[model samples]
Target: MARVKRCLGIDLGSHSVKLAEMALDGAGVRIIRMLAETLPVGPDATEEERNNATVNIIKGMMKKNRITTKHVVLCMPGQTVFVRRIRLPRATGSRLHQIILFEARQQIPFPLEKTIVEYQVFDTEKEREVEVLLVAMKRETNEEFMRLVRRIGLQPIGISITSLALFNGQDIQRINFKDISSKSGGGLSGLLGGKKTTKKKSKKDATGEGTSGEGVDAADQEVLADLGGVPAFEEVRAYVNIGARSTDVAVCKPGEGASVGFIRSIPLGGNHVTLAIQKACGLETFTQAETLKIEKTAVLSGSFEFEADKTLYDMDACQAATQICDKLISEVRRSLDYFISQPDGVGVDVVVLSGGSALLGYLAGYVEERIGVPVELSSALGNDQIKCATSYGDEFDYTSFKIAVGLAAQGLGIGRLSVDFLPADVRSMRDFSGQYVEFAALIGFIGAMVFFGSQIGAESEAKYKLTKEKCEGFTQKNTGGIERARLTALESKRSQIESKATVLSDFVTPRDYWLRFLSHVYQSKPARLLLTQVVCQPNYLGVTASGATTGGANSGAPGASSGTALPSSSDPRSGIVWIAGEAEQLNVINTFVSDLEQSKGASPNQRCVVKKATLFRYSSQAEKSEYFAPNPSIKFLIRVEVQDEEGCLLTRLDSQPFMEQTALPAAGAAGMMGGAENGGDPSAMGGDPFQEGRGGGRPRGGPGMGPGR
Candidate 1:
């Protein structure tokens, strides 16, 4: 049997938590197990108790699995994060970054300093401009997550948005040939924040929506001709995932070539009923309320639902379900409106609903009339594909399990969309102007050396004449040895000056020193541009850069801050963020628990967030009180450990280097006090280490780290 790689998808919810794990094999993605753990939040349960109940569910899973995760993708709640679509200059280097930072500061709701921000470029036109989707979550939220995931021994590599999971059901890049296939609003997306432009459809855009098997013979002909492979019909159909609180609609339209369509959560969700049940019954113990609500209020109620024929929900339950149906109708209307707003507005042909809530017997009928779209129970992946997936027990709920199945199916090479969309080398710093200054300074020194050589030559000629005369005069006294010693000493001084010509003569530019630096720069691998203030700043060439090659034992993660002697610490958490979210605030309860589990030795997991903030209200003398509190916001900062894997703290030298590096500009420049102005070397670098490599790869204050590090 082939070893199957497991993909686990977890949905963090207020009332109930859902987990789905699947394994991928050659045939396809298989469903392994699906779980909907009862969330014990009750009307009267203490917040702390509710938090623990949520945390324990994940903890129990880890215990049963026996191994911590290697790579895990997590999601944030739909409510906590802010998402914005932005437009910036079509740039790829540092300028691109500068613009991104600038845009964030100007547009994001919170100050740029207070958020764990990451961005994705959804649409790119290398020459024109780029469209990016920026997401910012409270740093406290991320920190808590780090803590929790660590507790269970999993590396949470990428934190994706909840809405993104719906789109994962289709390979938008491969499946979307034109604007229509991309998404209903992809045409408008192209014009997002740009000039308004309407999409014009091509013949490919006219493709009618159909099942992946509708043109099975033609697909088979190509498949056999191309790879001698059979067509996968069962796996290629569309799926609609219904969640506890929302509905995700997507259709992997299929014909010979079909359109790909996706629409996000319908306002209608199972949580509506749960909330209704909670509100209507006023139950303190949700453990019991949840059962009553699901059994009585949900569509699968009566004998068809999970429980026995007993129904806990009554007339009030009918009201909740009716409201849910109403919400579904509104969402379906909006979804179709979105479709019509697209380049072609061609509707999807097939839709399969999946989610525990989908089991409601009357839901299809209720949703069908409103959606004006065909609906059916989701079918399992075909036999070959199923063989690739882990065998699930017959009791597994297909609806709740579809996310894990889809995420896992990504492993089977179905709808694998990268949560991380930025290119690896996108942030490269390419400005090499600093090197030109150095070369120019070296040339100036060389020119000065030439002048000195001329002077020395003149002195030598005079000395030669004097020496001959002295030889003549001293012939009788035999005093030539002292004269020769003096001449040799003068020669040695010139040699010493020549040796320092490159560095000592820095900043004195000659015409065209750029060509000189460029000559050697091509050969310097990993060479970086640092402090390239090329515009008339004397210090531009007077740039004192410190860098080093890799040496000693190095861990493969980002080292520390490059003690470039910056007066500021990039880490928002260097001290306390005087805002609402405090250093002590636990935003993500489960994550905090995980971090607590991962905490080793003396260090507790640390997070940087704004504790409090205000609208910058300025007042007179007595207005400000000593007891005033700041609402700290969230920001990005990484965790530092005294230890490495296998429970070893980093070497003292290693940790100390970063600390000093992080602290240098604060401590070092504080003492320098205009040293550069008073004949101090602007190029006089602190003998710190980060000067070794380029970018954030090397640690702070290390010899190899470049300026950006």
Candidate 2:
């Protein structure tokens, strides 16, 4: 599908503003609307007043016609804009632009900074130099014009000069010069049928010879050559757009794709003719002069006469209008002459007239006769390239809209000369507007990223909070179980300590029984006999009987011999205490054995009696005497049986109550017996007796009373 675009072409003329609403697509241009609104300000009005009036008129026209398009292309008045066709050395790209810029600065009369210059390059493939069409206008002039258009809320997309626009308005593809020539033949003859020429000129007249009696001048021959010699298709056409205040002229070579080769603007136009008529007839106002020129006045030509009943005022207006028209024609001819005199010039084969003032009576015929070239009025009525809506009636002046159509064509990218005089600021604004969709898409993408990112962040935060809460609850539940396990371990350790203490106590209690037995032995020793050694063995009967010394001899008793048996007991707790002594006489030996048999303990029922007595040897004088003095002594052995009725001799005793009762008594007895053994002085024992008993008491006899002695 082809994209469609609509634009309004606004021709801001000095006396009138014309608008054409054009719709363009792949097919071509379509005219949706056309309107012309005349400005009410007079020629003598101030520039500010004129601009104000033009803006109001344009606003009214758009409103009245219901033309709503704001995108418009404007054609600046030719007089206010500079147009030049320059030939330069062939170049392209930046090099060409630089050359054009240099040329613009040199060609444009105003300073380059204060001027807006635009240019278009013509097809120069066949030529050695580049042909460029340069158009420039003062910056202030262009800005002020654009400001007035903006006052009506219209956007000016492009700006062009009137002469170039007129050149663009010519549709070369649809323009058949043969048809135009045929149509022009009738119109010219019908308007100028009474005119006659005296001489018949031919090409030979250029060499001072002709087919007639009088030869034509060199200028007349040149005019005839231009009028008659060129083929219709190869003809070069000049477009003269006679506007209200200025006339714009454009010369184009049709052979070169209708490219404009020359352009000029003349100060004389339809308004000048109206003013001339006004001054000649002494009209009260410009309005009346304009009316008269439009209604009755026409330019005079050779042999052409007005109606006899034509009023004198009408005739005066015609002559006044003719003189101004002749001057305008002379200026147009001079422009054509200048264009022809150029090095690359071609004679203008035909002249086409357009604009509001081109509608004057006999103007075409008079210009054709004066310039000696065929003249045709330009129109868009039957152009196939531009479709016009029938809603704008047949009475519409299509010729006056040529510049507007050209502007619309330029906006549609269809003009031959595509130069635009849009200011730098306006071009930037248009470029920014063109990229609006891209900007919108960028903003939307950023918004989507932000929205999604925030959503993800919020969801992550929620999940983190949930996980944290679960972990805290699990920690709280495990704390109590840990404390209970720790307390159970402590209780088990305490039980182990108590059991160890009980085992230690059982080991300690049995030492008390030995202390009590030792006390009994010390008390039973006889005078003048020293007890040498005593050994008490626990679980002694559990040993073999051969190793026992339970039976021994008694020496001093009557009928006693070396060996004597004492009574024996079978108690397992009844251990043997072996006793040894040295006596001074034999009687003393027998007496010591008797006293040991009578030994008692802490309880009345506890007895430690001698079980056996023996006389081992008799010594005459004491051998190395320590215990026996230097008297005859006998050495004897006695074995005793100690009965532990209270069970104090048991190896393991856990009876805490019984152990406590015997503890103090056993200590005191051990102390007293230790003193008696040391010659009845308690100070002779070095340390505590209780400690000595626990550690195995010291030997009872003197040191020399050991077994060797």
Candidate 3:
């Protein structure tokens, strides 16, 4: 055998817990250990007691099997999960997830918030439609299993439905398709064609009355074909996994392009037949009836000889057992019929049975007779599929352990329909840890490359220095006054370039400051507030803005009061940032203003002061719908000024260069300030305050300086 890895697969059923440990190599599987423990619940056990009993049973099984690996995969019971197969348009590039969500909303009975949904897409290249298998389970149900599994000191790698896992465990994928003939255009017809069976034209025939040697209806033949077709790379078929309390019906199509057609659970199983026997035979206890049903009943003949002391009683007991088998068979036949009647239905080539109940003598033969198809009992492993570590006793039923084996197959990364329902948090943590390891490895690689490159660069530099020395001697011998004059001109040019570079190094454009200020204002503003413009006001004007007093307005305005402290009145120093905006509610605008005042970026060097916050206008009707809605609402303005930490207006070094060239006349400044208050134009408010200037700014008679100079 090639190198193999061990995986533990666990199946938690209502009455029993099955655990299987398997070592899987390429195309090979070995059963390391397989064990099943009945749940220790008593007849009168409470829910809590039942859970405790289950946990103890599981603990014992793990200890007996000596399963140490934390990498475990669990099979969620089929009855708890909702499975649906849907077909969607074949278009690509569309958001498939959105489409699935929309379909889920329509199909899922419960509210979306209560469930966790997962899906697998079938690869249908060149087909007009795509098939998808969608599975959903209640959040609480999934979390309960996860919590229980965690308590046992195991990490769940994936959680899948038992039916899907069963599909993975079998050798259905390896069956040769060329040997099977599609005579009836049914996938499974060729495999099941030899022993011809026919159905009579009666109600009993329609309701599943044909024996194995009889022919079923033409539709039934096709249905059987669809149920077990293995045409090519992909095969679609139905799987019936019977458990103690429920039977899972899953239609599986396996290959690189395979998908589940449908899956559901019928609440009929071995226990139901046992209950029927208990009721019909007047049995006093359930255990006695169960024993009689398992031991005394034979599905092949539907009758068994009992004790001579009560010959009539034996007949009655035999009749009761037969009735129980008929009921169970009826239920199975109905489930098969339902599968066949569905859209895109397929025929079942053969019925594969595996479960604790499947071991009841002659059950497989009985189902085959009634359904008019081949029925075969499944084994723990297919021929040449797995090698056993220890010889299993003949008394041990390997058929009952198929589910556990399937779960192990899923964990070994060899299961089809390998959809993981692990919670998002666990997946995220795993992905983050994996990425972290990769990142660390990359950093180490880069460090090694840098060290090697530096040594190479040092050696190259030494060679270049020696080559330059040899050229310098030839150049020195050809030197004269023309070269000297040219060198002098080059030195002058270098000095002039250095001076210009120094001046421009610390120069910040007025446009840059405007962008930074506006970004901060918008970022700090509330979502409901709509901003129109930001107007910066000079401190020279002795105006007291609302909610703030800057050095008493005229405190240091060139020739004003004793405490006047407007330091850069003539220069375009720090000024009030007026934000004009509108809101549907007055409080929203107020909140926007408050948020700006509290923002650190708006403060800029801890010199921010909220000057004015007031409603500028109330509009009842609007030219644009966004500005006015319903009743009248206020359009507001808020002004904040940046000052030095020493409580004086400050000028930045970057702004000083531009400020000197854009000094405006007092009358022109007054007109701009008036326009700022009235919300005239955004340009008037703060855009290019030095649009018309002598130099370094737009010229007075430039293209943007109005029609006349």
List the global CA lDDT of all models. 0.42, 0.63, 0.57
- Global lDDT of model 3: 0.57
User: Best lDDT goes to which candidate?
Assistant: 2
Model 3 lDDT tens row, 135-209: 888999988877777776676667778887777665433433333323323332322222433434432122221
Q: Kindly report which residue stretches of model 3 are placed more than 4 angstroms away from their true locations once superposed.
A: 1-4, 42-47, 89-102, 124-128, 172-238, 252-259, 277-288, 297-328, 393-396, 428-646, 649-709
- Candidate 1 stretches with Cα past 4 Å from truth are 1-7, 23-32, 43-48, 65-70, 83-112, 116-136, 169-240, 246-268, 278-289, 298-316, 342-351, 379-396, 407-415, 420-709
What shift in Å separates residue 593 of candidate 3 from its native position after superposition? 16
Query: lDDT of candidate 2 vs native?
Result: 0.63
Q: Which candidate model has the greater TM-score, 1 or 2?
A: 2
- Candidate 2 regions with alpha-carbon error over 4 angstroms: 1-4, 172-233, 306-313, 380-382, 392-396, 460-709
Best-to-worst order by TM-score is 3, 2, 1
Q: lDDT score, residue 334, model 1?
A: 74
Compared with the true structure, model 3 gives a TM-score of 0.56
